[model samples]
Target: MTWTDDDPGQGEPPAILGLAKLRTARAQEIRRAQDTLTTASGDAGVGWQAQSQTAFAAEVQKTAGDVELLAVGMEKQAAVLTQYAGQLSQLKDRQRILEQRRASAKSSLARANAMMPGGLFSEPTPAPFVLAGEEDSTAEAKAEEEARQRAAAESKIAAAQADLRAIESEWDALVADRRRVDQSCSTALEAADILGAVSSFSGSAVSAASPGDLLDRLSVLSAIDLQVLLAAHPELAEKLQAASTQDVATWWNALDAEHQQTFIVGLPNIIGSLNGVSALGRVAANRINAANRLEAIERTLADWKRQAAQPGSFTNATSQISALEDEIKYLRGAVSEPPTVQLYLYDKDADRIIEMIGTPSPETKRVVTYTPGTLANLDGFYSGDTQSIADWLHKRDEDGMVAFVVKDGRYPQNPLTEANDQQYARGIAQNLADFEEVAFTDPLLEGRQSVAIGHSWGVANITVSEALGAHYDKVVSLSGAGAPADWTPSPTTEYRDFSYDDILQFAQDIRVGEHGAVWSGRNPREVGFAHEDYYDAPLTWKSFPGNGLVNPLLAAAGGIESHNLAASTAPGNLTLLNDMRDFINEAGAPR
Candidate 1:
């Protein structure tokens, strides 16, 4: 393989050089063809590799496009689900309102039925008559007829009561259904983030994450959601703020169980445009506004219900507001100015009347006190002569200074509602406090009598009656309540000396032979106390109609009937000393 640089390979022959030249020329041609072939092969391999790579890239891009389309479809479906859920929730709310109305009607119907007559009696049987008077068959026949009449009445009462009970049961079932629907709506609202605020700038990331991931990221949505909620449902939002730690824990627990899986599996791709500009914000705002307006309208409708129940309220309001200017002479029928009642404050400290009616009572005596439950207003005093048993014994004597300790306490016409009960309770409590403040400031009432008389639910005022330490004397309830179900004692009984029969009987005894004191005249029913036994048992049988006497005015007063009776018995301003003294002694005395 060693070759000389020069010298013609050491000895070149002319003929041989010619032969080698030919051979070399042929080899050079062969080598050129091989090089050309190699280059062509290399170029073809490079082109094939590039084409394969292009095809692979197309396949990857197609796969990505399919995935994006699937994500879009999922998002659309989620939106539709949200909309349908909202619609269902609204429907449920409407159903609840309808059910509430039905329930109210049913309750009224049941109450009416319970009040019907005969249901209050026990089954009638033949009676034993006196031997001397029973000799005649005619007398026995008359007795049999009376018994038949009584039985008929009893049957009618029973039928009415049964109907009422059936209606009430149906009403109860409907109420239960209403509650279920309300709960379902609440659940749906929670999932839809009804109260949650959507931020235009940074919307929920839940839309983007899988359902599981969304649950993990819900905390991220909490702050904005809360803001949105406050703007949407102010009342509910306020409640949310006041919710206890336990409530929040419960809410979170329930929420986690309900939507955790859905959020995680479908959130991310679903959250494509997670900004406020999206449908979530708009839908949330619209739904919240609708709900709020619906609630407000419902409240308005409830107000109308009161008007419907008592046409008198509407009538009074109309007359008062219109000043009776549009009424014809006949319609205005002998209109007379109602005397204005004034609350006089007798300052025990100054020994003078400090303020007149429309003013706070004067804090005088050693125990300054204001007694309610009677015709409270000195001006608007009740003139009727149906006196409470207390009044018969307690009103002033013949001598002006020797008058009994009786005072006319005004009670305006006011209906009893849940809201009314709460308001009245608060008013009475505050008024009691006011009395204490006066006592402290004045020297006269230092050791005087401090007492408050609440007639009906006004008995609730007893809750704050003893604000004056031991200064209070006696709290007498005329016709007080028993327990609603009678499984236990009356709720307000522990707070006062409860009595109905005693007061009624006492009232009867005091007016036995007095002038303007006839039992029939004193009772709105015009039935003498001697005959009350015949009514009491039947009236007490169930809960409605002839069983319970009806006096619209008394119902409005909502206090013990005796207090109003006292005011009615007294013709003018008179002392209630006799009544108060008697009641104090006989608070628990036997009938």
Candidate 2:
């Protein structure tokens, strides 16, 4: 039976039973044809005529075999259809039972209304007319009993209505399932017919047909169905794996919007991880995933709140509840008011991409991705640090548009001890490379200058990403902790920043002397990279142009806060910003 939204009867058992009968008849016809072919072969003459007859019989047998296969496929399709129909029938029966129960409830409620002195509309009959000398207490007790009965009747009615609603919802779901199953069966039947026809062909026609066409046909299927098809055909999965990024994007975009949304919802892990899919598409899917995660966290927080009053559990619950709430708050803000091309490469299991800002587009002339280190997260990225850098770059170069990104590379809890670990930088570097590849594919961004800037341990991340094959025109290691001893800069131009008064630098120098290497083991200055000593750079009170005393005091303070102040836009650190601007301009300038 062909199922459609408007045709309830088509998905019923009777229609499916009829389909089964038709399939059985078709199978019988195929058997009859086989018998007829055998009889015709028997009627052929002997000797020279027998040889011709034998060849004819062989061709007939092959055709009969094709028909038999088709019949078998049809029978299987019929069985599946019957099974789905039976499921629908059972659901309908359950719905009928629910309706019956609801009707019974209504009848009971009516009877109670009629007998409880209410007459369906009036108040309780005056407590059954208290007789002369009858105790008033007895009459009051009767009235209370009548009120209780009325309440019980109302409760029964409400419960029945709720049950009916649930049944209706289930019935709707059943109908949807029936429709999907019917579509799948129909597709199988069509395929069987085509295969049967192809098998009947002689020579190389069958062998010449490529499975690519069949795989392409599945592109029109629902995401869930496609997944089922792939699971059944590992070869198809291999084909998909071999597809190019552009090919993947094209295939993904060809699906209807509804199916695309379904894929995003049903298989986010798959869609989000595919490198060939457009970043915009991945972002769309990832945002949904993030929202789902937030919902789950909120649900857990609610559970925790329910158990918060237990003895000795209040403090722990409160702390966990606060953390969950904060996470939800951050997620909501990140997903809200997203850019036109918001890409979410976040992995909830790893809590990656704490924040990624701005959109990558073809029109972008320059892309600058910043990695923050040590306790840096969504909160830190949104707290002016990311925007200040973007603003500085934009102010420096007004002729070109820049896409500024703030990537939180899952920094370790202890920056001092963990900054040297190469493991932490590995994943971030790979992700950076992938992001660059996907983001720069647009023709408009061809040959555009791309830069990776890391602050503190972030520099180590940038260095590792470069070592891992992230191609950028320039790399900025601002106040870097260190990198691997074997690591080499990958960018065409590499710039290193070290503030002399920076306490981290002093610690790093001492650590290098003790360990014979910086945290990463290789200091950028020791290598063939340009260096900027922000500590020695002159400081000026731009806000207070004539305050001589204020400038020196501010400069002294800048030295003490040099580690962070160098990256800051404070008046005392104006020289540091100027130096950064010059470095970027020179590096980004046409060669």
Candidate 3:
């Protein structure tokens, strides 16, 4: 049931290629719809067209243009994914070939070893003094042949093993490249603001007016008609779905106590996922959402398993079922966690999620929110290191601080991907901004200390969020790349950047955003950042506490690497822990 893409022949072929084809099909469908709209607009004439009719025709043309733009974006996305899938297919093929060679070499080595030193042709050897002509010529010949066979086997084995290692290295490179291409393609679509664009074009309606107007339109419909319309346009059914957080919060507050309770129960998905909504209300809403989603995924998983068991059926159904199982595991894991852990937001399909470690109440004095860099996914939400880190941060200030770990959709999984792209950070920044409004706008918590921590790519996300109006009193960067080169932070936001002898800084320019923001391609300790400070020398100890007689130079050289120091400094007495303790005191927050 392990759906691994890293091992060739172990799982299904790359599903990414299939996804690209699906997008292409959707684009074709949208293109056809756009053609129909354009043709209908052309068929209508000014002779019978009243003022309202003309306006309606113009709106139709506008919607057609929007649909056309969406179709183009999807086509572009499909093309990029297709190219990426081709590259992955090549890598997979190369891996399989090398594995076959390794297997053959191993078999050859085994056969060579089975040839005994004195096989079939064995005889007593004559001493030097004895008659040399009487020596066993057959034995000598057999020994020579056996020696050659052994040497040849060793040579072949070495070559095969080396080739296999090379393939593994290529696999790592592919993972990195996949992230770069994925981020670039996704950034373009996100910049176009094509959220649910395909759905909007594929018969789902989007209202041009306010939520109230949408409700008014729906209120008069018969029960049967309402059900059909709502099925097609669920976005319209939840009035709060399209509104800004501020507006939703205001509207929710204006409702009487009884009505607010009714809305929380009626539309838990919308109420729970909204920022600026009450903390407890969201927890209640999100719990219901998670339960419902988990139940549905379980049902689908059972069906997939049943299909997979049938003879001659696509065994690849196992991969699909395994993915659903992961989602279910993550969903149900919340029940086992501490009661304080809040399911702030969970959109499994979109791959965006937020989790809070504790209650964000008036008594809360400090808040620490962590945004991960790369190599993270929603599938591992509950069982990942994020919860461990959250617990660590929470323990730092048990009474006052609330810690949040956010995975704001998909992130570029490679450090070489160069996540300084504003596009990559923009969505995360918006989420952080909304989280701040929702978490800290209360009486005492509003004035409390807010700290934002970023490790690796998260550093860029935090800074971009700051630029986008996510206010934080302190920011800590752990081996993270900086934001845009020319971008400046407000004087109110204190920045603390930490970097060990990290080598990722050297590969920053390999794949960068259009803005071309890079990591300066030099050691942070030497060149230092053009914008932020590098404080590794003072915080990181040259020699640890108990290094009694060890060579000072050797001990210094044995220091931790950049990624480890950035990840967690809790154990092994690494250099980063000292800084973390200082930060816990300095920022008056932890986690």
Best by lDDT: 3
Q: Cα lDDT of all candidates, in order?
A: 0.34, 0.60, 0.61
Question: What's the CA error at residue 547 for candidate 1, in Å?
Answer: 7.4
For 85-146, candidate 2 gives per-residue lDDT tens digits of 67768756765665576577566556655544455653554545567778777877877877
> Candidates 2 and 3: which is better by lDDT?
3
Instruction: Show pairs that collide, candidate 3.
Output: 393-591
Sorted by lDDT, highest first, which candidate order results?
A: 3, 2, 1
For model 1, what is the error of residue 88's alpha carbon versus the real structure, in angstroms, after optimal superposition? 68
Clashes of 2: 2
What residue runs in model 2 are displaced by over 4 Å at the alpha carbon?
1-218, 222-269, 309-315, 337-343, 375-409, 442-446, 489-491, 494-500, 511-517, 536-561, 566-575, 586-591
Looking at model 1, report the run of 10 residues with the lowest lDDT sum.
397-406
lDDT per residue as tens, model 1, 350-371: 2211111111123322121323
Residue 532 in model 1: lDDT = 19
Q: Model 2 lDDT vs. the true structure?
A: 0.60
